[model samples]
Target: MTTTTTTSDHADDPHLIGPFAIVPKQDCTHLADHDYTLPASAKRVDGHQPPCTDCDAIRENWVCLEQNCSQVGCSRYQQKHMLAHHQNTGHNICLSLSDHSVYCYGCESYIDSPKLVQLNRQLVEASN
Candidate 1:
């Protein structure tokens, strides 16, 4: 199936910017068929399907979830949208389908931080 993005970038130098640079792409296989509720954040989707927070359009709004929105009071908070990892935080483990989202491990954009694996191992050891 062909992957179509619902977002784009406006650049005067169109040749300098590639389509991939702004395309809100996602691996549909990992996406839930229906919209799911995120009670903790209280972000709701009016669309038939919950928007893929990582790369799909939500309702009629299209945003790039690849990184946390840098806009002040953009509605998407830094804790939810930013993927900048810390040793204290194992991963940007966003289970939300709104605000901040992530790609599946198999997806090309997935971040496989060495820190995440190390943290997981530590957790296992502590539990054991």
Candidate 2:
């Protein structure tokens, strides 16, 4: 894992409210279509499941914007993004990219990785 945090574009946006920032109005459940299902070659090498067994957010192969690190897993991408937020926001704590958990173990209820976009949409919808 890259411990080298960037003060670059990955830094906190003054616009966001919490550690878990939403992309605003982007639908989480239905991301832009990718034609067919993800091929076996597209799977994460990390052994952790992608698309989230819980939310079913990623059903296709959407590559990460970051070159060479093109992870297609919605949960993995979200977790990595949130991990950066958690690191920068003074909420520094145990975060596992492998486990993709923001909270401590034995806890019930979690903010679903894919639902963050839906939450953003709701906020957008509510404000309008």
Candidate 3:
């Protein structure tokens, strides 16, 4: 995905030097038959934000969206725990906890589809 960086409003914050927005792919083949809701067997976290299962990071976290797997992990920019999860389990897709963005590791891009939009909305509501 192509990313464009611009200055952030919070100039005083070192981590907020700029905002990074990823230009997502229009669709993903893997999500063609995805069930938009979390599986019944999926365990829900108690709070709105949960830490990564592998590293306990609260920021830039992602939840695996393969089958009944809901494993949370730190983003690639942090510890790459999600990448490691994909490598070990072959679970391709994940949803970002911070922004509700959907990503497909197999496709190597963020996905932006009608179904994904619905799914992201469902997740946001579920989290709340």
Clashes of each: 1, 0, 0
Q: Which residue segments of model 2 deviate by more than 4 Å?
A: 1-15, 27-36, 46-128
Each prediction's Cα lDDT score? 0.32, 0.34, 0.73
| Candidate 1 Cα errors over 4 Å, as ranges | 1-20, 41-102, 110-128
Top candidate, metric TM-score: 3
Better of 2 and 3 by TM-score: 3
Candidate 1 lDDT score relative to the true structure: 0.32
The TM-score of candidate 3 is: 0.69
Q: Candidate 3: deviation at residue 114, Å?
A: 2.6
**How do the residues 84-122 of candidate 1 rate in per-residue lDDT, one tens digit apiece?**
221123222233233233333224343323323433353
lDDT of 2 by residue, 1-128 (tens): 66754435555554344545533322223222332222332344444334532344443223232212323333334544433433344232222224332231122123234433443343345336
Per-residue alpha-carbon lDDT of model 3 for 1-128, expressed as tens digits?
A: 99754465545543232365456777578775756654332334565457788888777888887766878888999999989999999888888877777889988888777766557667667767
Give all TM-scores, in the order shown: 0.23, 0.19, 0.69
lDDT of 2: 0.34
Which candidate number would show the highest lDDT if scored against the true structure?
A: 3
RMSD of each: 14.9, 15.4, 7.7
